[model samples]
Target: MHELGIVFSAIDTLEEVGREGSLSSISSVTLELGEVSGVVDSYLLDCWRWAADRSDLLRGSELLIKAAPAVSVCDACGRTYPTVEHGRVCPYCQSADTELLTGRQIEILEVVAT
Candidate 1:
């Protein structure tokens, strides 16, 4: 799955960060996940556990994910609402003229070193 690729990419990035900072080991990593990013948490974690253990700096490191809510802004009403609930339609104005404001990102927010 793509989760393995994502995990590998994250680990590569973490390795670069570690090398830049001369870190011996990483204890944890906190990641921010968008609600509509389409990455499954269980798959990500499983991939993380498998791939991270293969890295010297990331073996046993914890991967913590925080969910970010999906938001959409309505052009007709100039209001923001949850994208998951109402989808492309604006709840207040019942208009389809809406754009996604957030919830399509995956970012690493924090890293703890040992």
Candidate 2:
């Protein structure tokens, strides 16, 4: 699954950063997930747990996830609405030209380490 890849990549980045900073252990990884990013947070956390235990640096590491809200702006009305609830339809003018303001992203915000 793609979540596995994402987990591994996150671990790899953490390991690299730890090496650069001489950190011996990692406590947790905090991630910011978009509402419409097509990523399942539970699945990603499960995959991360599995992958973390297999790595020396990440063993016993905790995964923290924060859900980000998706907002889109309507071209016709210049109004913004939650994309997850509206589904690309402008709540103001029912316009199709909606531009995403946020969400649709997966990013590592921080890593707690020692």
Candidate 3:
């Protein structure tokens, strides 16, 4: 699926960073994942395992994921609620005018080089 493509893109980015830092090997990578990012953690991990081993710089690297909660802000209520639970509706005031404050994120946080 798209996880494989994401893994490839991450590897490419890591390789570029490694080159810039003159790093020969990477020990681990940390990714900050949002609750509503739509990227499955298990699938992403599997893809990482498969792809990381193929790259010289990331042969034995570990992929770590940190989950971030999905939050939504209600315009009418001026309050925040969990996006996964209430979605676009504000649970407090029952308002349909809401916007997502967080989640839907997929980004690299840190990389350990060896």
Candidate 4:
């Protein structure tokens, strides 16, 4: 799936960072994942394990993911609500003018070098 591609991209980024910092090997990587990012954790981990093991700099490295909740703001009501619960609709005012505030992220937070 696309998780493999994402893993490859992450590996590339890690390699670049390692080169910049003169790191020989990485121990772990922490990622902040959003609820609406459409990335499956199990799939991403599986991909990471497979891809990381192939890279000398990333072999045996750990991939840690933190889930971020999805939030939406309603323009009509000027209020925020959980996106998973109410979607684009504003629960308070029953309006459809809403915008997603979060939950579409898949960012690397930290990388630990060994």
How accurate locally, in lDDT, is each candidate? Answer: 0.96, 0.90, 0.95, 0.94
lDDT of 1 by residue, 25-82 (tens): 9999998999999999999999999999999999999999999999999999899999
List residue ranges in candidate 3 displaced over 4 A. Answer: none
User: Candidate 3 local accuracy as lDDT?
Assistant: 0.95
Extract clashing residue pairs from model 4: none
Task: Flag the better candidate by lDDT, 2 or 3.
Answer: 3
Q: Please give the range of 10 consecutive residues that has the lowest summed lDDT in model 2.
A: 33-42
* Cα-based TM-score, every candidate: 0.96, 0.93, 0.94, 0.95
Query: By descending TM-score, how would the candidates be arranged?
Result: 1, 4, 3, 2
* Candidate 3: tens digits of C-alpha lDDT, residues 10-114: 999999999999999999999999999899999999999999999999998999999999999999979999999988989999999999999988899999998
Q: List, residue by residue over 1-114, the lDDT tens digit for candidate 4.
A: 778888899899999999999999999999999999899999999999999999999999999999999999999979999999888889999999999999998889999998
Please name the candidate that would achieve the greatest TM-score relative to the true structure. Answer: 1
Give the per-residue lDDT digits (tens) of candidate 2, residues 1-114.
988988988888889998999998899989998998888878998999899999888899899999999999998889999998998889888889999999988889989995
State, as a TM-score between 0 and 1, how close model 4 is to the true structure: 0.95
Q: Candidates sorted by lDDT, descending order? A: 1, 3, 4, 2
Give the count of colliding residue pairs in each prediction: 0, 0, 0, 0
